[model samples]
Each structure stands twice: as C-alpha cells, then as structure tokens.
Target: MISMDEFIEFVRGGPLGPIKKWGTKWSLWPVHLVTACCGAELAHAFACGYDGERIGALNYGIARQTNLIIVEGAITRKMAKVLRITWEQMPDPKFVIVMGACGLQGGIFWNGYHMVKPSDVVPVDFFIPGCPPTPEALLRGIRQLQFKIETGEAKTSATFPEVPLEAGRKPRVLPKSPKKISKAPAVIVNAPKEVDWEFGQKLVEEIKAKVEAKSVTITGKNRIAVKVESDYIPRAAMRLREMGFDHVKNVNVIDVPNEDKFIVEYHFSSYSVKELMPVIVNVFADIPRENPRVKSLASMFPSADYMEREMHDFFGVIFEGNPWMGRKFLLAPDAPEFPLRKDFKLEEEVYVR
Candidate 1:
C-alpha cells in the first residue's frame, strides 16, 4: 500500500504526473452517474459529432482506473449514500464534476426531506449549473476539467461560476403540470363544514388501553408525543393502525444530547378515517443515542420504507426491525459519521484511516 507521503510524491513527480498534462489535453473520461433528469444533456454530450469522444473525452464504466464522477442531477437520500461510497471506491487523484442546479442544492427538491447537497459528501471539482445543460455546455465542463488538470490545479477547489437557469422550462419530458380533473360535485356550493375527528382523544384512549409506557405527552394540534419505553413502538404502531391511522407521513428523530436521549418521532395520518382527514398523530419514544435503537415501522407504513432508511443514514439510529438499514443513504459511505446531529459540523476536517 502507498504511504501518504509517497502518494503525494507520486501525484506530483511520477510518470502519472507527466502524462496528466497531455492526457488532460486529449483524454477526458467522464464517468456518468446518471442520477436524475439531467441525463438527457449528458447523453447529448457523447452523441454523434457533438461527440465528446472526438476531443478524447469518453464515458467509461466506473472502475478504479477511472477518476471522474459527473453527478447528473437530483440524488435522493438513498442515492446520496451511493455517491459517497462510489467516490471512496475510485482511485486517488480522482475528480468530481457536479452537473445541473439540482445536484448542487436539491433544485426543485430544495425543501424535500430526502436530500443532501452533493458538495457535502465529496469535494467537488466543478459545478455545471443548469436544470439540464446543453451538449455544448457539457463539453465546456470537460474542457474546464482538462484545463484544471493541465494547469496542475487542485481538483477539489475548482468552482463553477453561477449562471441563472431559464425560467418556466420543464425539467422532465412529461407535461409541466397535471391536467385538471373534474371536481367532485358532492362537496360543491354550500358544503357542510367538515366533521373533525377527535383523533387526540381516540389516540390517548388507545395508548392508555394498549400501551403500558411511562408517559405519553400530547403536544401541538393533531399531534401526540408519546414517551414510551423503547421496547413498545411496534405495539404502539399496531394499536395506532387498529385505531384507524393508515400511513406514516414522516419519521424523524431528534437527538437530545443534554438529556442523553434520542427523541424518536413518527408522524402518522389516516386514509380510512374521513373525520380524521387533517389530523396527524406523532408517536415519540426516547432511547439512549449511543445504543440508539427502535422498532422499524415499515410493517405498519410501507411508505416509510425510504424514510427509515434516511433517518438511519443521518442519525445512526438503527431501526432494529427494518429490512434495509445498511451503509450510506443520505450521506456518502466515505463520510466520517452521522452528520445531521448538532455535534457534527461540516467545517471540521479529520483524517480517516
């Protein structure tokens, strides 16, 4: 294995160093991680005579010999893990080119729960900003990467200057907006005020009747924060389902380091309960963060499949009963540790062996 000092010397002085100048001038190999909608322009970059290969830049399969990772677009929390792991797996002297606005910040998914900034995981070499760049724009990015390599510039610090995206352009080929469907006639003019279900009352009764936890606190309208013993979440979820809640809308866990407890919260709502339409019930439990563990709700809410995976990704809070809870999800596999907690600041740099 190459020692750190020898690796640095090889990067600066070997045959690898001399070839970089000429290779960058003619051989730009872009490894496509066609993550989202921006793949169209990426395809155009290599298509007939817009032919990226003519300039000696070719698209290659991800192999250790390959050193470029071009992030196409929106990487869901699940894919974020993949990006990180892939970065770690590539050989050293690797470079990253972040393509499109979505890859930078989450783009239209800015407020989406299942997202992490690409730069947060790996040191980005360049960011090509557009919803989907044109073939010419993609070629320009390759040229820029080659220029940087030729100049012996640091691959991790090259920044792509900002360009505004065109307004009102559809990112996907599908219709810009869904066609309006006819409204139901039953709730038209003079509709009676909707009956509200006392979800809180029903929830409390169900918990009291079924769960033997320490204390269940009710907080916020349509929200109940339960402080159950860690072992009973599965039972609580089953009881909540029996009480008519059908889906889990969000699964969030807050780490309270001061109290040495992780506040595990699962927000649940119902499809079968008409009167409970707007009500949302939040079931919470506290567990020690060091050994933070909770029952998986995938059985009760199939929609929570990815949510649990994401929570497991950032908090290091294991869902003991979850089917999929291994490796990276929102953060890269190369990331040092759980990053969402208050303690894990992005500015800190610590070398990992």
Candidate 2:
C-alpha cells in the first residue's frame, strides 16, 4: 500500500523519525543475555549508580519485549548459538550492544577454541571495550547507540589496510633444552623464595582426618583433592568449614559420556586462616550419568549456590537438595541436551537460527 518516494524518504529519515520518535527513545528496553564476567559491570550500569533508566533503558530479561540487547562478554560456540537465537527472537529493527573487550575479539581468551566474535553473531550497534568496562562507559555506549539510530550513521566503521591471509611467514623451531632456549628481553625474572605457611600442613592434616574418603591428596602446595563417596559430600564440606575452609571457589560438573559417570567437584578454599592462606580443597566424586543426582552442599557453602545452578543449567545434573532446581534452562532452553557434555554435538543441535 506504501509508495516508493515515501519509502525512500522514510529510509533516508532513519529509524527514530517515524516509528520511535519519542515513546521508544524513552523506553529502550535492554535484554540481558549475560555470558561472562562483564555482566557485573552491566548490572552496575542499570543499578542506582549509573541509572541507565534515566535515559529510558530498562534491563529486561525477556527477548520478545526488548528492543535492545547488551551482550556482556565471551560468546562461546554454544553461547553463540544462544546469541543468534535470541537476536532472531527479538522484534524487527532490534539493536545489539556488544559490551566488554571479550565481546569485541575474545580479549584474554582470544586463542580459546570455544569463543566467537559478537559482531559475527549479530549486527552490533555499539562496542564498549574494557575487560569489564566501568558503569559510566557502558552508559556512554548506550547513548552512542541512541545517537547512531537517530542519525542513521555507523559510529564504529574503520578504514584499515588489509593483509593477505596467506602472507608468507617463517615458523620458529623450539630449542631442546632450557640452556638452548633464548631469553626474550621483554620477560621479567623474579628470584624464587621458599614459601613456609605456618598452619598450612596442620590445617590440611586436620581437614583430611575429618573426611571418611579413601584418599585426601594435597596436589599443589595449597590445593587439596579428596576422593569421596557422592553421599558424603555434605558431611565432608561441613568438616572442611570446621577446619577453616569457609568459601567454595567453584562447583564443576564434567560429564564423561563414554564412562557413563559425571565428575562433580566442589573446589573450596579458606579466607580467614592466615597460614593456610588461599588454598583450594576439591572434594570430588564420580556420579552415574544414568541417574545423575548428587547431594547439594550449598547449605555448608553458600557461594556454591549459583555455581550448582549453573552446573545444573549446563550438565543437567540434578542437585537433590537445591531449592530452585525446577526452573527452565538458564543458558539454553531449547538445547536438545547438555551441550557441554561430550555427547551433545554442535552439528546435531537444532538452533533457532
């Protein structure tokens, strides 16, 4: 029903002129699809300090209701599928804000196999570059997006000389021994000193005695690994806290499809003990994949609460005692199975894109 001249003029007038002149400008709902550590800064940006809501940008968790998406950081191959799907689910004339240095080009994880560029996944409106950019910087990025949409000008285009992909470069051969290895001038050398922790060994001994596990091996100087029954994790975790191991570092659940067992580890460490310093003690167990249910030690270590939730989100391993384990998938709702597990093939997964 629309004519060509009007269509041409509308295109020239840009997105904000007719459809989003005032109401949408004052209601830029941002969909939060947090992937990495930069999510912390993003939370601050939306929170009281930065108050992104001042400009009418509300951080919404739903995809259908949001016009803008701020991808936090590091979209893994699995998360890339999620990013693409979420982008597609969003309404027409949607905008993407790729936040953090990791979102730009993988940052510290550049060489990582799992990572993918956010720009490649979606048509990015703005990029806020920092490991995890400050809340003010994130707000500035949102403002930039608003400006670009209003003006119909790409704010981030760059002109650079292109290098040939097949440019000839010689590969360096490695030396056989330390004496033969050439020392680079940029490298710094600090003299190694003896580390004598006052109560490290004593704490380890006390903690080891409390666990009824087969073996409590001190792997690194400050790291301990305990092989325990799946049923005894709660008791073991309680005892570790009594021995000054207060905080849980992480709860890692590695799925071994071939072995039909899930390797669940509770990596705990102490913050209060002076001599024990910052030691991580891992209490691990091999749980059956057929019935992947484990005793949740979240009561003993509150930090393990979200970690267990994330583990359940990725591995489908049920923590029997977790209060909120019934919620739909956190990362991948439509994923066929646990993508992080060995058997969930990328080629086999039916992505919305």
Which candidate number maximizes lDDT? 2
Could you tell me the lDDT of residue 96 within candidate 2?
A: 92
What digit string (tens of lDDT, one per residue) describes model 1 on residues 1-353?
99999997896778787776676567656678887888888888889959888877888986565788889998776687788888888886788988898998778877455567889888988888777777787788777787787886744334689999799976755333343435333311111232343666676677778766666555556656555667887787788788777999999888776666677878878888896667676677778878988888887689887898988888888997787776776565555567777456433223332
Assess candidate 1 and give its lDDT.
0.75
Query: lDDT of all predictions, in order shown?
Result: 0.75, 0.77
Worst 10 residues of 1 by lDDT: 185-194
Output the lDDT of residue 283, model 1: 70
Residue pairs with clashing backbones, model 1: 28-57
Q: Against the correct fold, how does model 1 do in TM-score?
A: 0.47
lDDT of 1 at 139: 80
Q: Pick the candidate with the highest TM-score.
A: 2
